[model samples]
Target: MGMEYQLFYWPSIQGRGEFVRLALEEAGVAYLDVARTKGGMENMLAALKADAHPSLAPPFLKAGDETIGQTANILLFLGARHGLAPRRAQGRLWAHQLQLTIADLVSEVHDTHHPVGIALYYEDQKKEAKRRAEEFIASRVPKFFGYFERMLTRPEHRGVYLLGARLSYVDLSMFQMIEGLRYAFPNAMARLEPGYPGLHKLHAHVAARANIARYLASPRRIPFNEEGIFRHYPELDEPAA
Candidate 1:
């Protein structure tokens, strides 16, 4: 493609932007990870404030003169544009829905640490995080993963992915989620994995892809840390049920 796409996200952590980056990388598309570069986050913020329509958050994309925000929206836009989305209308809608669900899970992951408010530090809300993390580990994680597992096992789509016979943007997203959750809650994931063989296989499959393997090996894939979503607070994570 002649037009280079620009992705705006936090400079340091992978956060939500990694979803978009993975899709772009898998496609081998040439694009600018704006915030990762020098002066990139500043430029992104300036553009956001300068625009008539201020974005609700970071991880927006600037294609030509237009800018769009929301993690799932960015993926949908890129998925369609780059042919990473499913071709059939029904499949496309299902794929987008899957992506939205993944986004919801991601937000919940962030909320485990920032339940009271994003402004508050994890230490400030460590008690609250403990409570939220229990609910997340005991209820929410299984619910979300169960839904995905069932979807993957559907007769119409009986394969490793949400959509059978192809790896869509949602698959990349699921892989990211699996990676983050493993980092943040290693104990929980270890116990949980055996039950979700479909998800486990999907995670392994995505990691094995040539582009993803290359990306994971490269320094560009930021390490998970306490600063971002999916933090590893020992008190918040429980041994698998």
Candidate 2:
């Protein structure tokens, strides 16, 4: 805890980095958003290459001398250190399992905007993106949201958070998911959100947390933009049937 955690990621756009940021903020952990600092981009680039176990991409964490990569892996590590995850093996694994599922959903969301390839501009893949987004909005949205809704409404875990009564990183990620999807697909969400009352309630619960509220109000919380996973492309979003 003495060593200040250093987060290495892109200077702009919340992207996947925001998930980690939200966990840290909610846990009241002090971390240096390295890329936002002077010469920080260079530092991030260097860390990506120089580390013993180089990460495939950004959004990795450096705690003390250990470098943790991947969003879920990093979260798994931080979740244990902080009280952001469950104490027991079964509960912790359950939290991580939900996190992995969320990761899959996030990947799908990214592909909707960049269906053809990440290297290609959205303009180059507009037709494909439209098709993908249409299917996602029609099918995937309900599939994922319904699963989470049911999870929250389970018999045993009858709480506002995902892992039941406690506030886990899963809840934080769900809040981000709703926030991102709402930005990316406002029309669709406006029509669809009413069905998922538990998610709405959970979103409100996380948003009102003292630390998270402060973070949201501060400049540290980057605004959603075209560059992030959640983009407000008018054609890609529509109200549900």
Candidate 3:
């Protein structure tokens, strides 16, 4: 690539930024993980304050003169440029819509562990979290998976991906979703996986991709921990119905 791709995100967790990282890694694009660089966190904070276009949070991407924020927005831009998205306008919109839906699920997942507020500790909200988790595990999980299940059953989407016959950013996002859900709710996923065979198949297929498999084995991929959106709190999760 002519322009240097600079990714500004927190250095520790695989948060939202990991979605952007996955596209870049899959496409074999060379980019600098700016925050991981020397004084990278300082640089990211400084850029946020200094740049003419302000971003509300991290996981922003800078490419030459243009800067983009939001994981879906970043993925949309990268998908079009890197052949990670469909060619038609309708296909593109469908993919973007799917990504936005995934974003919604991510937010819900985060809230399961922090029902009160991000400023408060999880311990402060465990009771609420448990209630929220019950609804989420019993309702939201099947609802979201059902939507994708229907999409995959479409005539055009005969393959493992959510879009067309090929893998798009949406598929990658689904892979990330599965990874997070499994890490956070192993028993729930194990029980639910049987019902959503297509989703599990998609997840396994994406995991087997050459680039993704390599990325998984690499040091670059951060392991899931307590800090990320998907956290494994024994009380916050339950076995699937």
Candidate 4:
């Protein structure tokens, strides 16, 4: 029988939840996508408010009596349980390091539109978003992508994935990042793609994974839109190359 893992996240936006979802799907693990289910968001909220421990922002996991929060932490827990994480001490730490880096990039992506404050709306903060988006497109995106590209191209682990041979949760998160960035900044990504062949290849390879392909085709995966973290505003994108 498959393990029972319950995921709690916001229903509307993919955001950080996509990272956990991707890992679950790729691992072929049967799990409950709680918030996406009927009345799931309400249940998630109740669970959060009731907990004595410090609750996470979103995308948490529950296994039996235990509840854990944060995207990277959830992924780490699942990775070790499902044998997706490396057994070696160094490899395990590296996987976590990669995951944390992805988390940082995800936050930067969110901040591009809501840099001033999360309490404010995009329409209310359009001016700040434009300025933040400029910095994001010009510097942040390239810096993060360049780092991952270099990691993948490292001589010690020079194959397809960050860990050379294995397909870890980090690989899935990178694919999601690439997808989100392409949607959020199409023009910038088009020009930037040429410089990060490793990332491009990684994106392509992950897309071809059977489970990922199925998840992409299925209604379970929400399409990118204005409401999500990675939103596509033509103004935010750079000029087409």
Return the top candidate by TM-score. 2
Question: Which one wins by TM-score: 2 or 3?
Answer: 2
Q: Encode model 4's per-residue lDDT on 72-156: one tens digit a residue.
A: 9988888888877898878889999999998899989999888899999888888889999999988998899889989988877
The lDDT per prediction is 0.87, 0.93, 0.90, 0.87
TM-score of 4: 0.95
Which candidate number maximizes lDDT? Answer: 2
Write model 3 residue lDDT over 90-198, tens digit each, in one string. Answer: 9899889999999999999999999889999999999999999988999999999999988888766578888757999999999999999999998888888789888
For model 3, the superposed segments whose C-alpha errors exceed 4 Å read 1-3, 239-241
Candidate 3 vs candidate 4: the lDDT winner is 3
User: For residues 44-134, could you state the per-residue lDDT of candidate 1 as single tens digits?
Assistant: 8897888765687888888888788888988888888887888778878989999999999999999999999888778898899889998
Q: Candidate 3 — worst ten consecutive residues by lDDT sum? A: 155-164
Worst 10 residues of 2 by lDDT: 1-10
Tell me which of candidates 3 and 4 scores higher on TM-score: 3
Query: Candidate 1 at 123: error in angstroms?
Result: 1.0
